[model samples]
Target: MNILLDAAQTAARLPWAPLVDEIEALLTDPTVQVPPRTVLPMAAGAFLFAMPGCDARTAMTKLITFTPANVGTATPTIQGDVAVFDVASGARTLILDGPTVTGRRTAAVSALGARWLAPNLAGPMLIVGAGVQGQAHVEVFAAALGVKQFRIASRRRASAEALAAHARRLGLRAEVVDDADAALADCPLVATCTPASAVVLRGQPRDDAFIAAVGAFTPQMVELAPELCRAIAAQGRIVVDSRDAGHEAGDLLQAGLDVDAMPALADIVAGQPKARDARGPVLFKSCGWAGWDLAAARLAAKSRPTG
Candidate 1:
């Protein structure tokens, strides 16, 4: 039976709360397998996924969260779909509208990093780029981390104000900001969600910070600036989903970094690469993975009512 996890049914619920424990459990266990993802991007849309094998069959989950931020602003932050198929039999068991999945799951991934990496990271947070990822970042942090203060910074000051107002309606202490460059310095954990051809967060903080630069996979697109990349590189470690994806990613590619030199996030999560040095900074660049979605799908699938 193909099950559809409707967005309306799941709204205003804590989707990622239980998964924090599941994610933690999955993190500690090494036996669980998620195969390398295949990504397809075009002017029309993009899809990313990985297959996590279980015995005779593997669960291949995909998330095609499109670039409809403009359209979704009137509707959802994302308008896409999610699916689960059998790796061996090639049989799909479920499909779901992905606005719910995309909103919560990516945030959970970032939250996992935030919980583990960001230390003494009290928030009254500041988010750069008032878009899908930016707003979602705030929700996951606030819901999971109990963030109290949230400052929204965007190119159009009006948009930032609108986002802040929408956020306040949800009861968050929020506001709009004119300068993203200024916001980065004070916030301990900065999540850069902007999608730009060149870096927007060039002057972002250098002070032993925890940064989740989650966008910019295309060779032409970038989120953080060269200076920010250099700053993080100089500070110490860079953790990625796959060295391959990070290498191909434009932001780091433009930074003149040897992508082959960086380690996979698996290693860091597994403790092969410690989260930080004695006292400096760390950069967690997520070329957001299929494995992450696979993890989230596994969590979401488990939440279904057994009838």
Candidate 2:
């Protein structure tokens, strides 16, 4: 039997701390399997993606489409479904709203990245882009890493203000800043969640800061500047969610980075040593991977009601 979960139900089942811990276990586990994803480009700025993975016990896949034109309409930019299956019986178990799985799992993965890269980060952190990913990240960071102060920025004042207001209701200190640079000025950590085709921030991040760039999955979109990429790469501290990021992440491509030279998040989580410039910032470029979806889907499936 297949269980179905709407976005609200999916979100309700995933609490940040345990969900983040599950992500951490997946990232650090050497046995988790994530195959290369498939992307099919469609005309007029739309693309279809299929991502599949397994956690030894269960298999799952996330099938999604990105349509840029949806932004102006009432539809969401990302739409699709995630299917979870029993490994032994090969029975379909659950189907979840793709956007909710994507948003929550992505933010959980980013939170894990921060823990591995900068475990001691106390906020006044800056989150650039006040959309769904932005709000999710704020909640994840606060819950997973104990970051309580945030500076939220968006091209529009209202959007930033809305996110900041939400943050304040959590008893956290949050402010909307007009200048992106000023918002990031003394931040120990920063999350760039925009879908800009060009670079968003103008200057380099603080030397001690760690950056999580969760946007810009396509080669055409770039959120981080090349100079910032170069500065972090110089320290040999760049990491990505998956090896496939070499093909999908625009921020890394725009930086002229050799994806092969960057370590996968799993490696970092497993305590594998990579070149590290101790004084430079660490960069975590996430091009959403299949394994995360699988893990999340399994968790959601386990929460299903039983007769």
Error of 2 at 127 (Å): 0.7
> Which prediction has the highest TM-score against the true structure?
2
After the best TM-score superposition of candidate 1, give how far the Cα of residue 295 lies from its true spot, in angstroms.
Answer: 1.2
Off by over 4 Å in 2: 272-277, 304-307
Task: Return the top candidate by lDDT.
Answer: 2
Q: What range of 10 consecutive residues in model 1 has the weakest lDDT sum? A: 49-58
RMSD of each: 3.8, 2.5
Listed in order, each prediction's TM-score against the native is 0.82, 0.93
RMSD of 2: 2.5
List pairs with backbone clashes in candidate 1.
Answer: none
Q: Write model 1 residue lDDT over 19-67, tens digit each, in one string.
A: 5555655656555565655555545544333333332233645555455
Q: Which TM-score value belongs to model 1?
A: 0.82
